[model samples]
Target chain A: MESILRTENLCKYFGGLKAVQDVSINVSKGIIQGIIGPNGAGKTTLFNVLTGTYNSTKGKVYFKDRNITNFKPEKVTKLGISRTFQNIKLFKNMSVLDNVKIGFHTQTKTKMLDAIFHTKTYKNDDRICEERGQELIERVGLSDLKEEFASNLAYGNQRKLEIARALAVNPDILLVDEPTAGMNHIETRNVVELLEKLNSEGLTVIIIEHDMSVIMNLCHSILVLNHGQKISEGSPEQVRRDENVIEAYLGREE
Target chain B: MMDQVFSLIQKLRAKSVYFLVLIGIFVLIFPQLTDNQYILHISIRILIYMLLASSLNMIVGYTGQYNIGQAGFYAIGAYTAAIIATRAGYSFLLILPLCGIMAASMSAFLGFPTLRLRGIFFAFTTLGFSEVVRLTILNWRTLTRGTFGIPGIPLPEIVNFQISTNNHFYYLGLFLLVVMLFISHRLINSRIGRAWVAIREDENAAKAMGVETFKYKMINLMYGTFWAGIAGGFFAYFAGYISADSFILDESFAILAMVLVGGKGTLVGPIVGAIILTILPELVREIARYRLVIFGIAILVMVHYRPQGIAGAKAEGRRIDVEKEYEAGISENAVETTAPGN
Candidate 1:
């Protein structure tokens, strides 16, 4: 299968700190891929670099066979790649549905003049976006609370809403940063199931998760990082037994 | 006939259209109710400032861009219309849109590079722009006449009707206010409107969602300053004078204060702020210079207690909690604005 995303020799540095050095990843289409590393391993820096939040010192990022390296975040999104922040960056004061509707922003085609005239085109697009937002809210099990503010949601629901928002962009590849990071066990399980459902429906999901069990069971292939370098990339079982992966997670034995 | 009248009143209760029509009729006949030209003059000024404040709201309230140089744009519109009207001898209708375009161009020039700066930096840049505008007008003696000010601006004429009397200006102001309200109401519930709120809520998230923050900011500035220009043209003709003194940095803050006090992001906020702030000092004119002191106190009180804006708090009771919002990782001031588009 063709790779949905590819990075070659991706290097990011903060002064002398090699945040992410020589990290190459090829995420095949329609798979749940995970990036696992201990603290200071640069998983987030890598995600930021990939999503165009940070400039890479040296590397090329390919999305669906297009050179997308260092493209602005909005441009990167326009090219069919969407991402959610690990820190949950939903429009807090907006309603739950509006958060998801914002995801459909780039895909909609209502101009300012159309809006000013209250044109039929604007109305039609608005209705469709609302309906799609409703459907996504239902899919994420936020149907009953669609009218609530995003910030009013509980921790787990907020994470789920973030995912729902990311999914709203209608991306071929979804870059999720720590979706299950602060979620409870049950919430984590639901998220794992949600990712599986999304993947089964032809969405390629790349996750940066610290929750090891969620990664192990959910990701088809896992890439392990240590000191900003890729230590291992293989099937879940293979990554689990790898000595380098074990050392990266639990630290080197004396 | 009594029964029919009763039924008509009953129908008005169920349908807001009837209520609106009744208000429209009342407004049309309001001059008869208050024949005092002084009162009409104040009312016209209030109506003008309402338009100005609402225009500024498009940027400060809705787009979350701190623009403190609204008066500079307003001055541009005012001087542009006055100059064109004096030099070309045209109707205010033609001058109005010309002024808007002039202000919008200036706004675009300033906003294009400066909109990229975040928060206070952007505010100060606009502050500097406002100073630059005021000083240029002050020093350009041949064009603006400096402190002497431009006097004897001709009142606009529509066909045979001259908009010279207080009543004429009142009716004209009301007509323009209606036009502005219609435009803003329609625009606020549109795709571009949503993009603005998204940018205000979080620029990065908006960008990730494919909302070009810079483009939306420019549009926001253009829309905002466009109306300021229109109001400026109206003021130039209404006051029959144009001067740099009225377009000072203080005027910018006053308009911003109008948005903040009335409510930052709501449609109703600007009108409320304009009415309250414009009329407050006048009402307290019994104290003369102390009115400014009282006005300062009133604004301080309003901000201290109602930073969410008068309308935002009253409309939804969703006042912001800075610490809670910080913990949630989103600007709490987002609550200070309404997503009417949503």
Candidate 2:
């Protein structure tokens, strides 16, 4: 499979400690890939590095043939890479629809004066944004909660809204961290289904998940990390049975 | 159904327009009702403060930036205008906007380089910025005439008519306050406004969602400081004297107190705050030094009673935020089991 997002020898060090080291990952287009590891295995750190929250110590990242190493997080997002935090990062005070609209921020073309004057172009853009926000909310099945405060949504719905927000970016790749961290079984299933839905709709997803069931059920490929190092990378079935993945990740806690 | 909704919105718009017109008429007639110069004078001061507090609202209230250095911009505007108008014999009309741009540009110049400071760090830096501007004016003997300041600052003129009365200044204050309100109101309800709120609520999330948080924040600072500078220009002419002594850090606190007492993040909060705080001291003038004590207590009570200010949206107290939910769990997984396994 052709890689849509590739990271080579990425390293992130905090003083003496290496949070993410010598990690190379290639997420293919239109595939739901999962990054898993034991706690402190650097799954979230890897995701952060991929999304440009923290600069990689010594490595390169290429997204869609563009070298995007150490771009600012906003630049990364504007370049069609959007992410959700491990614990939901919804604009809690903003309405659900507004939350989704914020994801469309880079796509907006209205100038400061247009906003100040409510010019014809501004009105048109505002309407278009509202319609697009509504469409995403509907796609996520949060149509009924469109106007509600993001913080007020149920845990499951918040996860769905986070994905919907990421979708609003119209990203070429979606990096979701711990989407089902605090979710129940049904919520997890919903999230799994939502990731599938997004993948089916032609989005590439790179997810950090502690839920083994989510990884096995949803990911086409899995990369297992142990203490900031890539221990295994293969199809879900292969990684599930891989001796290294099991010993370092799956069997470590068993 | 769409037609009904459109017409309902139309009715609401028309009603608000009428309400605004009525308020405008009342404001215009207020001087006629009370020929007392003291009252008109205070009203003018309140209007100028309203502009300052409302402009400050663009940062503190809406943007959620803890910028207590409005006096820095205010001083810059005043000094730039005072220095030029005194040296070049420029009209107040030309000088007002120049002052605004000067402060706005200064704020942008300062804010851009130090955009990395988050929350309170930025606030302290801004506080320091005010001190720097003040010290420069105090220490610069050639340009600013040191502590003596520029006296006999010219009054504004219209069609060669020198507007030397409190009543005329009232209109200028009203005009600028409306401008501040209109611009801020327009921006806050639009994408720029939404982006600001998003940044305020969660900057990382806003950035991750593609909002250039720094750029928007600088714009907010520029817009706010622009008005503060303009208000400073008004203060220069209004007081008929320009002095660094008046542009103290205490003025910054006073503006902040207005925005907070009125409410942070609300359209009407600063106006309400500006009015109440501006008038509160005048009303308590009978008690002399006790007025400060009373004013301080009022601020204390207001802050204690309603941290959200009077017209603020959302719960003003500490929100049960998602910071923990977003990044807290990452470190906790340090010693736990391996990545989940089926």
Clashing pairs in 2: A87-B325, B263-B309
Residue B33, model 2, lDDT:
89
Task: Give stretches of model 1 more than 4 Å off.
Answer: B1-28, B286-296, B313-321, B324-342
Best by DockQ: 2
By summed lDDT, which 10 consecutive residues of candidate 2 chain B come out lowest? Answer: B333-342
lDDT of 2 at B50: 90
Which tens-of-lDDT digit does each residue in B228-279 have in candidate 2? 9999888888887888898888888888888887888888789878898888
Model 2 RMSD to the real structure?
5.3
Task: Tell me candidate 1's fraction of native contacts, as a decimal between 0 and 1.
Answer: 0.59
For residue A172, what is the lDDT in candidate 2? 91
How close to the true structure is residue A243 of candidate 2, measured as C-alpha lDDT? 88
Candidate 1 lDDT by residue in tens digits, B232-318: 999999999888999987788888878887888888788878988888878877765564455466667666765656555332333
lDDT of 1 by residue, A162-199 (tens): 88988888999898888987777787888888889999
Model 1 C-alpha RMSD vs. true structure (Å) is 6.8
